[model samples]
Target: MEQMTATGVSPKEVRQRADDAGMSILRLDPLNTWSRVWLPDNMDDAYIATVDTRQDRVFALCAELGCRSISLNATFPRGSMSIEAIIEDYAKICAASAFDLDCSLEFIPLWGGRPLAMAWQIVQGAGASNGGLVFDTRHFVRGKSDLADLRTIPGDKIHCVQLNDGPLVLPDGVTTKDDRYDRKFPGDRQFPNVEIVRILSETGGLNQVGAEVFSPMLKDMSAKHVDFARLSGRGAQDSHGNVRKDLFFTRTGSHRPLRFGDGTIHPCLWS
Candidate 1:
């Protein structure tokens, strides 16, 4: 929180900065809760209460932080709750804000091989026109979806996308989606980032292209933070890296995955 306040930053400040910097959207991350996997089944009741409280805190914090949208990393046990129930609860939580915050689902095929194509259909069927899937390049790959499948979605149906690369393995073998998700930035070795970027380009402006490749390796790099200015030109360097780091470093390791975002998606694609 101190980091947020020290720079005279607040949610409102973030909006102003984004506007001044020529950005239309701010990307907000929700904390992931995959740790539940390790907890003993006997502790379910206690953790449920605890998790619920934390979940409330998270929603309140996002609103308080002035975040207009959030990427949810929730993966529930299939029978634990139904998607309808989850969406209803999620809507109620996000609606806590007087502002309409887009509620996007982080589809993890970790639990089972649920189709990305099918999930989007369900979201659309559920009348969640305001919501969409958080499309991670690797996740989509693992989901084994072709770019053509994306055309079926109303361009706006894809809420956001996370860009990254990985081995050309099919999604069937991957046990949990989180393992693939918690990877380093786009051009890092061990992933198909370039092709994924192409897909995102075809789709056009999403809520954000979170270059959220984990930075554990670069935790100690003096260049931990990137210099967006050095790469600026007609670009003027937006908040996210337009550096367009081709898969050059993809064979090498990057400290962090690059991140990108903009508020609107190209509507004409659907038309």
Candidate 2:
């Protein structure tokens, strides 16, 4: 079993650990949540000046620091920021920067039970398909996405796959999204387990499955002791096995997932 540890380490340190562990450090996931929280999505010249100024600084800093890709987990500004504006801004950033956008990961409120693919379309529809998706397991499952959605996707369309877990029971009022991407490691409140891994392997083409966890909890537990390396190792092994199991089941007739109106496939969620 290979292990990658970036405990209390800078990007350089973490990247080194991944390399030493024989793991290819793929996404340099960054937090854009600061934008939605810091400034209004749309702004006049003065506001644009201030925000763009900061944006340029961020690009420069990330490049200088050796961080490559920036993850799009940004929320709306302080109160109510427009999703359209935020997405456009994300696109704009990608356009100006040297960052390699394999594809853009759209941050969304749970649409039904997972991040909205329709919202993802917003990125593609808006011409931001630098590639495909940087899908997150929790966000996808929480959006209530089924495995069938994979059928329509072309093989090379999937960009990156982020691996993490959460609980089935959601927090109060949010029957859909967990609103806690910033939280840490395996066993989240609503992270899809075995099935989540499978969907990516099957539909997403399994380009780059990574352990991109973000939790305040990691501060207390050093890399040497963090969750004792559970999710990335044994947990991943089991999850991968389950994915294979699903494929095995697919060979049978009755166990097949249901079909959408357009004949697109989706899980036959019988809950």
Which model scores highest in TM-score?
1
Determine which window of 10 residues in candidate 1 has minimal summed lDDT: 262-271
Report the C-alpha displacement of residue 199, candidate 2, in angstroms. 2.2
The per-model lDDT (C-alpha) reads 0.50, 0.46
| TM-score of model number 1 | 0.60
lDDT of 1: 0.50
The digit string of per-residue lDDT tens for model 2 on 13-60 reads: 655665676554334444443343433344356634433334454555
* lDDT for residue 200 in candidate 2, whole number 0-100: 54
